[model samples]
Target: MQALKHILYFADGEFGPTQAFRRAVALAREHGARLTLMDVTIESGIGADLVKRFGLADDVQQSEQRLWALTHLAEDWVQGQPARLRVTIGTPFIEVIQAVLRDGHDLVIKPVRERPSSRGLFASTDMHLLRKCPCPVWVDREPEHAAPRQPAQPTDANADPRCIRVLAAVDATQPDSRQLNRTILDTAGAVAGRDDAALDVVHAWQAPFDGSLPGAGPVDHDVQLADVLGLLEREHAAALTALTADYRTRLNGGDTHLARGEPAATILAHADALASDLIVLATLSRPREPGLFIGTTAEDVLQGAQTSVLALKPEGFVSPVS
Candidate 1:
């Protein structure tokens, strides 16, 4: 949640220099943060003899070529914005996370992989970074087309397809989620402020029960269940209010929503209703030992999301890779 001092922009393969890369440059310019553009080349599976026979570039040569290509690809976008270029040979996600660990990067920004089918939301590397990256990871949705830009002005509906609206989902009722909720809000606020966007906050709660009570008839059981649900709603509302008290000015009056339903479904519905350009959420909410963890709700939201996502791990999160 601290100011982003160092940003790592991962432009793996041919998906580089897109909206996400431009976004990284803009952020670095705004925050005076150091930016690094990186790429990874997976080693070929061919035998050494066959590789030599084919006159293919060795690993060192491949890395050097990748580095040059990355630098050239970013030249127009970076425009001498003071960014470092790097290329490593390995698995993409592992190399990216290791770079973050090695260089103390505070944020990882990358474009979402293009999918052949819409059944799966994130690719394997995207999921790996979301689940195991130590720093905050932003997977930007690939834009269908470029929008016309106005000189030195904030994005608006007339100019950009994105609504410039941000949806922040928080889990406020649980003790373990309080810190993560704060982090989510802080990060959301920063994005909204930077982009001159509107921020809306949502919390979803559920009250589960069977139809019939142990010693009650249908009517009585229904009445009791209704009362229990009402109480649960009140409790959830109170908790959400308390959690967002410090952010009252940032939220104003009309930006908070409390709903009763499944967490993932509710959050996605709320985001769609608001036409949010971005969703700020905690990838892992529950308390767990230091390792890779992504909550069920987070996974569902990510899979169902139609907009870009910024996911953060908990305070003590540790990557499983090295």
Candidate 2:
């Protein structure tokens, strides 16, 4: 929720100005944040001796070429916007994270790299960033059609020029979910405010009644089960309301959804129905030690999500990388 101070845009060797790049530029201009354009290339597979014997140029040429291309690409896309361009050589995700650590970048924005057909929307690098990046990571999906440009209006200074819808997914039932829930709401609110977009919050639960019923016969058991279900639903509803009380005014119609089902399924189904442009959710389930994988709910949602995602890690999360 804090104002972004430095944003790193990973230019993934795409030819033109991607939506993610434009978003990074706009956010920088809006928040007066520093913007850095970066790209990563793999280390050379050919050994130095072989290159020297063959009298071939070293892998440094590759880096030089990438830097040149990135510079020219920025000149075309930046359109007088100020930004620094750098090309790092190593594993893509590791280099990106190292850049964040070295430069104190607060947010990393990049276009979603799609795998081959039938695989998934996000590539492995995207998943690594989501799982490991210390700072917030925004993976933007490009629209199928070119978005029509809307003329800038003379509005409040803080108002965002773009119109987009954002969904915030949270868990309210567990004691450990409070911090992450609050974080989801705050980050979603900040994005909605920045884009002047509608925001919706979603929480999922399951019925408390187990198996058949308790005492008596089938009829009494049914009644007891219904009562138990109602109580549990109410408790969940209250918890969701309390978690989102601070964001009531920011929502469209003060909308909040408390549904009974699996968490990932409910969240994804609601997001699809709402046609959300972006989802703000936590990647970790609880406070975990360093080097742990993300929670199951988060992994399932990410795997199934059709829209862009802004993934956040819990406090004290440390990356396994470096």
Candidate 3:
């Protein structure tokens, strides 16, 4: 697998240091990649002294210093990795996105809460970034247990870090399903190549019958609808099964999971069941389709994913934001 060469870590001064920062350092150390620590804070000045009195005065200089306040501690734990700090004040995601595009960072990393937002599924900042960022975004979460206080040696990207179980999320029904599926498999396999970690390929699908189609007679039409659903299931399952068989041979070894329900829920269930470390997926948008496939299912997964998530946009896919 190709290592990430440039990574942007957002150190929102208000949220302070986070697991994403730690993980980004590890990734950078492994790949010897360029790491830029960006601290974004919005400061309005009419009564600047009043804001200072309330301890809310964070200009570029103060924000720069604040961004690195926790770096010494983190660097002590993860040594030999130096990151350039960026301090700016503007709308949070907008500034961050601009930096990514301007500087050509390959990945964006940010920390997220253990539980999803109660108001909706995803944090506003995270959702916004996930939707609009051009490059892949890695959303980091708090580890269940704390590591020992001693500093950790930088690990080789070629070697397995623990059992790096990879979960490749595939949408089989997309217009460009074949290419997207291949990309997902190629990435997961490359990461899991001949290592201690194993890959799990899962395709989440919903049965077509959701009472949307009308039936003529109560009993006879019920049987017909059931047959139609069964046929759809069989067709999809057969195709997925063939693909997984080929993947199993190509990847060396893995278990294929077929989930029947809402795509998001099914993907989450399988990820949790296997305790996946990384989830790789590409966003889906079609002109013929009313809404985005990735918006609902992928967004749901992105919000609830307890592990690191690598979200990719399909080639030639354009964001409406631009």
Candidate 4:
């Protein structure tokens, strides 16, 4: 529950650091954290080849000029605020990760471009950073202007302007479901407390089967299906209640939601419907066992959710005996 003191902002691409700059500044000012603005320059042969093939000038003056402009943009945003600015030249993803490790930054914020042309490269970089970053990464989507503005007057004290609404996605079918749920809720509560945001818990359950192909004739298929769904609903409700109880008093405003569908799809849909600013979830470190994965529902939510995401690794816990 420690306050985030150092934050690294990854700035590159057409977004030109505007969105990341604004978010870093806002969070730093609110928490009195130091901000480091970085613009990564790729020096690989492929990058040089691309520039040459694209007929970029030999002097490389234009690119350097653009970099200077970006640095100024960051500086202007941090004006009249306590913040530090940094600019680094290297592979975008690698440089960002190195900065996080070197500076001991608690959080890293970066803007995600929706559906980039080089999907393969984009996917590789995204997966690598998500899997390897030492600290939590907040991939900010939803353009800056699209974010909800602060209201003139406070309507509910429970709903703070700084309080971000988070929906934690959990799967009850896994053997470690209970432990995962607890970790996710605790992390979400800590973040909400830090930002003065509310926490909402969501658990999505679907039929046991994948349902990829039409089933053959079965005499009691409908009856059997109904029985299975009934059991699932009961278990899901119980799990949701238990998870909510752990942080009921700590949360400003909280609720539990249960839906029947694919975990990733249902969770994203609910987040959109609720206009959540972030989704907190626990990721599986061991895939061979019953648990989450790097490319599991949590990962999908991180890449697909319109809001920011906080993913916690599973460790430092012992399950209670039945």
Candidate 5:
């Protein structure tokens, strides 16, 4: 597996840029990777007018000042680590993607700032970048200050590194699920292998049914309910076991977990329990409708998972049989 050589960190109004910059610098130094810090300033007419009104004579100068301050801050924080600085003015997501492609970066890191609305809509930039970026995207949400300053010590109790943990979330019912599951497993294994960290394979299964009272249907249904649940449980266990068998062999240190409940809730609970550093999930490929692609489980996980998430695009599927 080719390790990420170049990483692009995107900064903007959200507190994420600073955290992304810091993490990128640390990882780059640890991995001998090159780092580029980019700040995207939108040139909307209103934004431009506001900049001018604020006594900024030249937009370029203002941008340069911001970049300089950020670059210096990163340099001082990293303490002589080598990194490139870039500042671009345009649509934030477009600029970041273009930079990634132009620079041939292997990874892109951005802070995930939840939108103020209760609907759990991420900033437009985050959604756009997550959906379209070709390389792996790491969306950090925890405040930087909350993170530990020193690297995690290696011992039997604290053998895992402080670097983010990657959980591959899969829907085992769909035939295509295996492809996504394998991709996530392989990618996550590669990441864990690189850092000598722990990788966990997680599948969230839910009994398919509309919410309804149990006894409302029929007395005869009562006896069949146990059979139905037993069948579902058996199928879920078989699927999880088959999926993990080969992967467990490939990743000697990895572990598999299966949970029965609401998909999002179960997955989040496991992630929280593990204190996962990151999650790797495959996006559902439904028709492009507002809220349609976001499944109930994925929506819940995306909005509520307390760790960073890496959502793989559905277009990357490659069948395992072939």
Candidate 6:
């Protein structure tokens, strides 16, 4: 797999900025990528309003102070690493999207919000980048909170919490899912190999609750359902096996599951079951308006995933914002 060479790390309002920057730097060092840490500020917002209410003479001064602190913190964390610090004041999504497109960044890293991971709920900034950005976006959900020693997701006793496992989510239905699956598999496998971790490939299938029937079925609904599911499982399993046959040596006890349920729900459940550190999946990209075209599975999995996600757009994806 072609490793990412240019990474754009979006600073998350001083919340775990240091750790997020460090992660970007670490991944950059791993792939010889350039790390650019960027922080965005808004000219008018609640914070600005609060500052004005406090009789502060300058709103820009306050923003500068915040960015200044973040820069120092990041610099201190990455003393010997090669990284760049960037600060921009504008609308968050537009500035971030501009940064990614302008610099030709192949990967983006930012902190996930502090709120609980759930379906259909995302921070505005995060949702914007996920929907609009052209490259893979890695939302960093650090295991620790402000308090000491509270891991965000449980980790195995022997496994390193940073990235003990990488999960690749694939869809067996799409005609081009083969290529996407290969990308996700190879990328996830490489990352896992580097960390001596496990790779789990999960494919969720919505069996025909009301789907097209194969033919006239027997009266027993359970029997008919079983027959249909068995066929689907075979096909999905075959695809997964054929793809994974080459990486037998790299993956130790890796698993491929053909789950019968909603794609987003199944993926999330499997990731949680495996305690996956990172999820790798491909989104069906469209050129609709910036926030209007997020795929259902992509949006839900991203919103509810406990682990960080590396989301990829389709081969010929075009951003509507441009």
TM-score of each: 0.89, 0.87, 0.79, 0.70, 0.75, 0.83
lDDT (10s digit) by residue, model 3, range 10-113: 86553433566666776677678888877676765537786668776447656666666646534554456677777677777888888887888888888763
Tens digit of per-residue lDDT, candidate 4, span 162-276: 4368777776556755765676777677767776777777888877676422463476677766776788789878876766776778667867788988788899899889888
Candidate 6: where is the Cα deviation over 4 Å?
A: 15-18, 45-53, 57-59, 80-82, 116-122, 145-161, 209-225, 285-292
Query: What TM-score quantifies how close candidate 4 is to the native fold?
Result: 0.70
**How much lDDT does candidate 3 score?**
0.68
lDDT per model vs. reference:
0.80, 0.81, 0.68, 0.63, 0.67, 0.71
Clashes (backbone N, CA, C under 3 Å), per candidate, total 0, 0, 0, 3, 0, 1
Evaluated at residue 63, the lDDT of candidate 1 is 83
Clash total of candidate 4: 3
Ranking according to lDDT, highest score first: 2, 1, 6, 3, 5, 4
What C-alpha root-mean-square deviation, in Å, does candidate 2 show against the real structure?
3.9
Q: Candidate 2's error at 258, in angstroms?
A: 0.9
RMSD of each: 3.4, 3.9, 4.1, 7.3, 6.1, 4.9
Better of 1 and 3 by lDDT: 1
Off by over 4 Å in 1: 52-58, 79-81, 147-163, 210-214, 252-254, 290-292
Candidate 6 C-alpha lDDT tens digits along 155-175:
322112257888888875566
Best by lDDT: 2
Indicate which candidate wins on TM-score: 1
Q: Tell me the tens digit of each residue's lDDT in model 5 across 207-256.
A: 77753336656775756776777788889889888877777754445578
Off-target runs (Cα >4 Å) in candidate 2 are: 47-58, 79-81, 117-119, 147-163, 208-219
lDDT of 2: 0.81
